[model samples]
Target: MMKVMAFVGSPRKGGNTSKIVNSICTGLKENGHAVEVYYLSELDNVGCKACDSCQANKVEYCAINDKMTTLLPKIADADCIIVGTPVYMLQLSGITKNFLDRLFTFYRRSNHTARYLPGKKYMTVTCNGAPAEAFGNVTEYLNQLFNGSFKMKNVGNIITGNLTNKDDILKQQGVLEQAEELGRKLS
Candidate 1:
């Protein structure tokens, strides 16, 4: 079975972002893929320190001794990564940004290559109160990170707008179905 790592960047439990991620996880599990979900807001993860310790030492993992350090191995071992977040101030949530920053550990200074998790499949789920078209830049940022920097394949993405409440996404049946289909395809 493929290993899938899912990160929920919303602090609210059972929020729209969480529900969407859980739906994706359900699809992955149904397809016989192992899924692990991490709530970023609950984790004590910190941003990249820019210490360059990982690069200098040529280590495969980050040097920071935070919760992300423990998750690094899991990330490396996974076949796919699913990131779900609620838009904040026209960008990703602070915790999600920090989590992405921690991924810098995967970059190697010797050859400017991603040391681990390269070629893995990745998908993003972004929920915003504004129109989806209005936040195309946010999606582009995610694309740059997953496709460009990490050198991962873009499996798919779910960008649902006008979701201000936890249950609002439930009304968007098509989006939910799309998320499940995306997960199944990833597996």
Candidate 2:
């Protein structure tokens, strides 16, 4: 079974973003893929320091000793990475941005290549109060990061909009089902 790492970037517990992520994880588990979910809002993760330490390979990991350091190995070991976020100001949430920044360790400045992360499968789930078309650029940005910069395979993306309340997503039909289907297809 493939290992899948899922990150929830919303601060609200039981929010729309987490519901989508949890649905995807449920599908991954049903497909017999090992799945681990991390709530970025609750983690002590920090932004990239840009110290060039990981680039130089001076330390075996990111120099920052935050919670993200512990998650680095899990990220490296996973066969797929799932990122879920709530759109904020036409972009990803702050915590999600910080979490992405911390992934700099995977980039080797020496060769200008991503280390231990290339060729991995990647997916994203984004929920916004605005219409889905309003944030196509956000989705494109994520796609470019995973498929272009990181050299990862773009498996799928679930972009849902008009979800303001924590339970609004549940009221929408087929969105969560689509997320589950996306997860199952990943396997």
Candidate 3:
């Protein structure tokens, strides 16, 4: 079974992003894949220190003595990863941005290459108050980071917009179903 790790980057527990992520996880679970979900806003993590400590140490892991010290290892080992975020101020929320910044640990500055992330599969979920097309840039940025820089393959992105409230996602049954199908088809 695939080991899937999902992160809800929205602080709202039952928000649009969380609902979409849960739908995806539900599909993966039905397929007998092992799924673990983490709420980024609730997790104890600090932004990257930029000390190059991860690249400096022989082990090549972040030196931060927080939750990520352990979580980063799990990320490296995960077969698939799902990241869901709610757009804020035309960009990723602070919580989501900070968590992604922590992923710098996977970069090996030595040879300008990345380690432990190539070939892995990743999916992104984004929710916004504007129309769906408004935040393609946010999803594009994430694609470039996970697909281009990390050499990870993107399964697909679930981009939902025109969501005024959390439960508005429930009205978008089509989007949720698409997310579920993605997880079910995930290898």
Q: Which structure among the candidates has the greatest lDDT?
A: 3
lDDT of 1 at 10: 93
Residue pair clashes in candidate 2: none
lDDT of each: 0.87, 0.89, 0.90
Cα RMSDs, all models: 1.4, 1.0, 1.1
Question: Which digits, one per residue and each the tens of the lDDT, describe model 3 over residues 1-187?
Answer: 9999999999999999999999999999989999999999887676887888777774557777888677899999999999999999999889999999989888866786788899999999999999988999999999999999899999989998999887999998999999899988887
Candidate 1 per-residue C-alpha lDDT over 116-143 given as tens digits, one digit per residue, 9 for 90 to 100: 7679999898989997777777778999
Clashes of each: 0, 0, 0
Q: How far is candidate 1 from the true structure (C-alpha RMSD, Å)?
A: 1.4
Clashes in predicted model 1: 0
Q: Per-residue alpha-carbon lDDT of model 2 for 16-90, expressed as tens digits?
A: 999999999988988999999999988877688888898888898789888899899989889999999999998
Model 1 weakest 10-residue run by lDDT: 57-66
